[model samples]
Target: MNGIPKGRHSGASKAECRPFLSSTERDVIRLVHEPGFDRWLDQIKATGGCENPVYLAGYTTVQRAETGEILRHYSTENEPGGRMPVRCRNRRERRCAPCSYLHAGDTYQIVRAGLSGGKGVHDSVQHHPRVLVTLTAPGFGPVHRATDSAEVCRPRRNGGLCPHGLPVGCPHRHPADSSAPGRPLCPACYDYVGHVLWHALAGRLWARFCDGLKRCLASMAGIPRSRLGEQLRLSFAKVAEYQKRGAVHFHAVIRADGPDGPNAAPPPWIDTDFLENAVHSSAATGYVQAPFSSATGERKIVWGEQIDVHPIRGEHFTGEIVTPDAVAAYISKYITKSVSDAGGLDQRVHTYEEIAYAPVNPHIRALMATCWRLGALPEFESLRLRPWAHTLGYRGHALTKSRRYSTTYGELRDVRARYASESIGASDTLTDAAWRYVGSGHTPGEEEIARAVSHELRVARESYRERVTDE
Candidate 1:
């Protein structure tokens, strides 16, 4: 490794091998000889030396709300550097790994809380009718897909051709890792315009599915649709994940609770069988029509024919009921993978031509081109499809939950703030603070130290967890 270009290094320690260092690293090392070095290092270490931390110049003063007496005062003037740094807090892994890890942890806690009831939910809610369901997009056209066995994708008994004189069948078995699977058999025959528009409206499609389910439940119970909400409330925590075909689908955990929330027992009419049927019916029959455009008339969208609903049972961590744990783990894994696996650019495209030069797969590029093209139409202006071209016209959060599903992200962060600092408290408390953003990120040498510190902390944490588990 040392013989390779850029990988060469002296056998001595970095401290002994390096004859020169950047200004930032030198400044940080000098703080070791300064007074109160322990306190300064502790503050910086608290953030795990985040990959892209925000630097701020600020002063905060705490005062008694009633008497107006100062309780405490703090400023960045006394710190090692004349600025305080906070984590960049981006959830996308490509943007910031440390903050993305934090976001994933919070998401796991949120989902687990709803599943087994904790963190602001009643434990008894675990007994409620709960199940995980998947909603996939309908097929736009036949594409290359490898089956489990010797079957080929779109094998034609008699060979056929598309409108553009391209073959309609694929004979070769495409490897999963190969880009051939997602590419259309004939690109000219693919409904790229509808694909982009469907994703642009996938969220609304989910909403219509939910509404349709409610209507189905009311029909099943022999009650009016309007009166169903009074007896039972449906709550869900869903995340959108991209399929290999560069389309988005939803995996959601749905629960039927009482009128109040997870704390209350659902109406007597609610049961696992009934809920399952409702979900299936909704996905099958629910439909929404998009507006007509210049090149095409109105199009109706429906969930794909395939749907899966698995009933959740028993406790999360105990014997006889390991499904909940698997569900929670699956969600965490999906959220992390979605950060980079969507096959689209993590950043937005500023122009239509940018899609052509984007470092992405052809599937995503085609979808992006469709977005930019359709977005230019005056009738589609309200969809804002152009801005989300990076996402292939999808503009929805990776994670979404019902209002009463569980605690919120804001609440989770507030709890952490209260635990980490004494400054956080009731909402009514008065806080006088002013901060200006100085900059973000470290010099090359400074980043080297930060990465080392982060690695050490991770190793320490894993070791501690192993010991605790063994005990």
Candidate 2:
């Protein structure tokens, strides 16, 4: 009944003349006619129209601890289908756009708190030395890349060929969004094994880099390594992003605090330039040796040559320095991105056949296959390349931070939850809650309706933002 063809074609037979409706349309009608439709709609709105909301069946009760009086009570017993909807809370945009949008906002706040302090962090952190750092993976082979300044992809005055007989240079100037940029010039010439192994050890390399930075800082201060922590503490928040060439790189906000933590001021010797120098030195010198395999031998993992360290500035600061807001927004943007952004899959692959059948370009497929092949080796079992084949062997989380860097995601969510719901009691409440997952996802028509609701909510937010900007 909901926009489905109510009448058949003019030239059709008796069966064709019957009113036709899809299962989704019938379900929509049934849903709207139910007594709990309004409550269901309200529940969806509460979840911000989550694409795949989980259904929960249970209740919560709060009572005054000393008075023995009930302060609040809530239950899903009367909800639609005897359950209430809650957001799936997936951070990947490809998985749930609504939840990811919310996650991105939280990420922005978390990163911003580190730079400019809020959400339980002391404001004194704003004065600390902060820098935006970019760490990249070493190149595995010659791959086409988008170039700025109108430069050719790989111009060569003397045309030459690789061992595989493919031209070693390209004269094309690819656009920033072109798919050809990430593809290797010659697939046969690419070091697929080396690329996969590097991805597997990227997390270890980052750890080594952090340790190297601490040593470098100690060396510059002319102090023993053991005593460095007594004078300065390095705090950072980082996000991993996949490059178009399928390599994972990191963007981080590094801050220098005193020995105590963010509330304490950094030492007089510490500054943006000081941190930048240490970052450059450590990135250059730091290395991690991959687990020795008889076939691959010992491979050393190190940061790429192009390390970008930009000093982070306050809002009023000018010139080329990146502002705190810019840094926060930059890191937040990457947290929602998955390996799929690099032409890879977000889901895990179980077998070689699954990797072969995955809907990905040849380069990504090759990387996955390489991960699977390498994962079988006893020496590389810890890397779990097979399980993470979908991500091209990169196993680290999308975002990570030092303990002193900023507020956490859990804290942010708790704040949001408290804001959404009224306080149960001042400090004298005893709360008990019981919940069980009932189901997830939506019927076809419900999916359509939820998407519409999500779009409308997004539009309302944008309109409100524009109005605020205008004022």
Candidate 3:
């Protein structure tokens, strides 16, 4: 008899009143007691079955096709511990540290491969003329910044106050990490349109910049635009990062490679000087126009005045240059970040209530409202701004690498699978497998137990590793 209320089971004997396991657990136990436990366990492990075991209601077998020889068979009963272990690819740091670490490591390796050349890329390609460039958004308004010179922070020329009674200028020297950094001195004057439009058109602006660079190179080489691709090519990997002021900026590794890609040498004429000129020309002229405002009839968008293009060089050049390693590390650091890193909203805005209650600054709030309003318009249906309101209407990839930059995501997965196979001395033969989302998540009690166990195991492992290293 299962456990029941005192009133309901008053007549049942104590022996019959024993509490039984849950139906789900009983189903799992039944499967574990089946004849094909070994094969079932193997399949479960391969498919990454679960953190908390799931019961299966299926069967499997292997037999000779022609002779019908019962070559092999397995059932759940043969499993050692009555359960299968599996890998969990949880991305949230709060959920699984191991998986998050794995993801970060893959990102680092991918970025590093593009920089120094590894995996499939040729190591010699690291010597190519390259640059680590950062493009910043224009000043929307006067924002507080740390300065060393006495004149830098002097808001008032001769000590005065604004109409609002705020100090005309700050005379004190501020530290770089001061809390007042990035706060607007006069929030009313901020050019919010210029800021939002810059973020929205960042990807398009990059495309135009690349085109300008190619044209600049072609003009210098005295080659036709159509023949430019045949002579040389520009390759790059870039990441978008948000500044403290909630504006998007870019960090890119720009490389000049042959048209044949990383495996081939560039044309003799395409040297560092040529690459530098192309970068400057592109940055100076790259611009994108915003959508025509119904109210204003016409409007224009453009890149900010602030642009940086640093030359990347190997030790042989002996000149000022950004290194490949530094570039890779810098880009990789922002791979896991979101708009939230820059004091912006993290979740989508679905209703007016959510937007009104959002804790972001007034400028960011205005952007969200704009995205929400535009999202409802039939003319802006394609932008899908509402679904991405939290991101301020930008729907481009956060980080993009060129084809020849490094090993691909698919290659990385394959390499990992091959390593696992090698460790088990398994033949590199494909196996057919199928799985479905039967269920997910842990029960409240089970979740608590699992968290505790995971924490204790991590602490023990860390202690052991530290002791070993100290020796």
- The candidate that wins on lDDT is 2
TM-score: model 1 vs. ground truth: 0.87
Candidate 2: residue 371 Cα off by (Å): 1.0
Clashing pairs in 1: none
Tens digits of lDDT, candidate 3, 1-471: 121112333455434644554444434444445676446545433533334544432224545555555544544334543333444654334345444444555766777776688888888777777777788777777677777655465556687655666665776666656655666665555555556556667778888988988989889988987898886777788878877777788888888878888766778888777887888888888787766667324545566787777777744334554577666666777765768765567667779779878987775677777777766766556557788778876766767877777776578877987676434222432233333333444444333334444555456668998999899
Residue 134 of model 3, lDDT score: 83
Cα lDDT tens digits, model 1, 1-471, are 111111124243457635664455555454445686566446546777577788888998887787777877889988767887788887777776667777888888888888898998999888889888888888888777855557777788888888889888877787687777777777778889889888888888999999999999999999999999889999998888888888888889899999999999999988988999999998898887877885767888778887988788754532434466667766765675552475778888898778889888777788899889889888888778899888888899989899999988899998898787675445546779988999988755446555655666667778998999899
Q: List the lowest-lDDT window of 10 residues for candidate 2.
A: 1-10
Give per-residue CA lDDT, model 2, range 242-321, as digits (tens): 99989999999889999988988888988888999999999999998889999888888888999998888764444554
TM-score list, all predictions = 0.87, 0.93, 0.72
lDDT winner between 1 and 2, please give it: 2
Ranking by TM-score: 2, 1, 3
True lDDT of residue 157, candidate 1: 80
What lDDT does the true structure give each of the candidates? 0.79, 0.87, 0.65
Return the TM-score for candidate 2, rounded to 2 decimals. 0.93
